[model samples]
Target: MTRLWIPFITLLSSALFTNAAQASADPLVTIQKKWAQCQYQRSQEKQQIYCFEQLIKRNQQALNSAPTRADLKVWLAINKSSLAGAQGGIGALSLVEEAKDLLEQVIDQAPETLDGSAYTSLGSLYYKVPGWPVGFGDDDKAEHMLKKALAINPNGIDPNYFYGDFLAEDGRKKEAIQYLTRAQKAPPRAERPLADQGRQQEIAAKLKELQ
Candidate 1:
């Protein structure tokens, strides 16, 4: 019953966001909220794959309508990555590559969009994806970009959390703990209640493992 309710509620919430996005004049605001909704539903992969796929189309339309907005590109890229993760197979590589391309543009053309989120996200992709012929994953580059993101948004939860995860993966347990702890204490984003709540849970889980 609980598991069934989880997806039922997720679909209901997605419908509400869809309605709100349709009513919204500003696609950027709509995309941001919708992206948040899509991400929160991410734990339910098959369900979110469908949800985010629809969102990807909407985002492409939104981006086409206003190509000047870098943030839109960022969110679109993020939604793609979200979709790719939900898929998680050889076929998903294309989506990851697509997102990488979009993030590169955001980094070059709009580093400040969403407070250096491009850097953080790009860095994450580098570390998370495979290397060489398959993808462009590179630890050194990831570290450099993640640090740059931190420089731009020192107090941001994502930067700290990702850097901490990177550190943990690299066996720097103490350092990872420091950053993870900071991420746990980072300020909440009122505009992104769902994402904030989800992230806080992730931060807690990461902390538990390291501690």
Candidate 2:
């Protein structure tokens, strides 16, 4: 009868949806675990650049397998950034450039997914690296990226602290003080104290010098 056929079709559709959901969830967990391991190795800071390169290769494999997942792409970006740092520390300029390109792609694709962490990273990159037309660092670009990040997440401590540090460096003392103070009072206090402390200390030292 038509009634019996309708129930069978509905049950089959539900089962298919359940299988697809499971399939989607499994790859994400695997990628996250691999990324976590990479971060853990980075925190140790003793791993050779080759070790990070190997990690990158693994992450690249995972990413190729699941190109549609934004989180995987973000994780891959973070690993690339770390690898860049490691390479730069060893004076490997070409590798650093390659990593920067990868990070740029991640930012272009998913600027909203990682709580604006990519913006903060890009801002730090511009702030720390030597600029074009003269030096490696570009304070103006750093300021713009940091501002965009704060606009995306006004209460984010990382952007607030970094922005305040940049302002302080530029001699905008009062505004720097306000931002640094806000950063110190922001939540996730335990995680951000280093930035807060560093900014507040710099502000204090600068204010003292001015007086």
Candidate 3:
């Protein structure tokens, strides 16, 4: 059986980071800034849920205002899925489904968005959620999509770290360590200081555990 690693510690550890100063005028920018804060600065799950909900509202508004930017869907799904992880109940399952649907569309409509973050996030979701009667978790598909993510972004911190985590959950700790190590060495994201630090911490914990 694959071990359950919450997506918050892995999947959402790499959210968008933008200049807060730039956010004052743009709604999407504001949403992205808050998204990073919700995931990185705020340690509490409930706070994350609240921040995401507020961001989702802004996202929906942005979607209505500027329908051409399909990229917003990616973050919308991510926050919902992150919220799902925070809420440990049957309701959380629905949020996962909603996220799944949104990601599937985002990949089809905008695979190139966010350097293929949709694929990376969706791939992680597959490995994190339950399969068959429960949800849509699948190790095999997780490998495929994760590889696709790497192809799009070989040096991306999120993809590398989650691929390592997937391998670790699948009992390939040795191989997992390889990816985790790379992720730990990944270059800093200028926009997302907090998210980078959080991921580095998670990577350190995972590396130590595996080593």
Report the C-alpha lDDT of model 3 over 121-174, residue by residue, as the tens digit. Answer: 888888988887777788899899899988988888999998998899888988
Candidate 3 overall lDDT versus native = 0.77
Estimate every model's Cα lDDT from 0 to 1: 0.74, 0.54, 0.77
- Model 3: how far residue 136 lies from native, Å: 1.3
Candidate 3, residue 160: Cα displacement in angstroms equals: 0.3
* All candidates in order of TM-score, best leading: 3, 1, 2
Task: Kindly list the per-residue Cα lDDT of model 2 for residues 1-211, writing each as its tens digit.
Answer: 0000000000000011256558455544444444434443344445645556776687778779878755555555555655656555335434435545655676788776556656666665566554554334577777887787788867765667667766766778788777766665656533223334444455465445534
Model 1, runs deviating above 4 Å: 1-24
CA RMSD, predictions in order: 7.3, 16.0, 3.0
Task: Report clash pairs, candidate 2.
Answer: 129-136, 129-137, 130-135, 130-136, 130-137, 131-135, 131-136, 131-137
- Rank by lDDT, highest first: 3, 1, 2
For model 1, the run of ten residues with the poorest summed lDDT? 1-10
lDDT of 1 by residue, 153-205 (tens): 88888889889877887788999999988888888775567777777787798
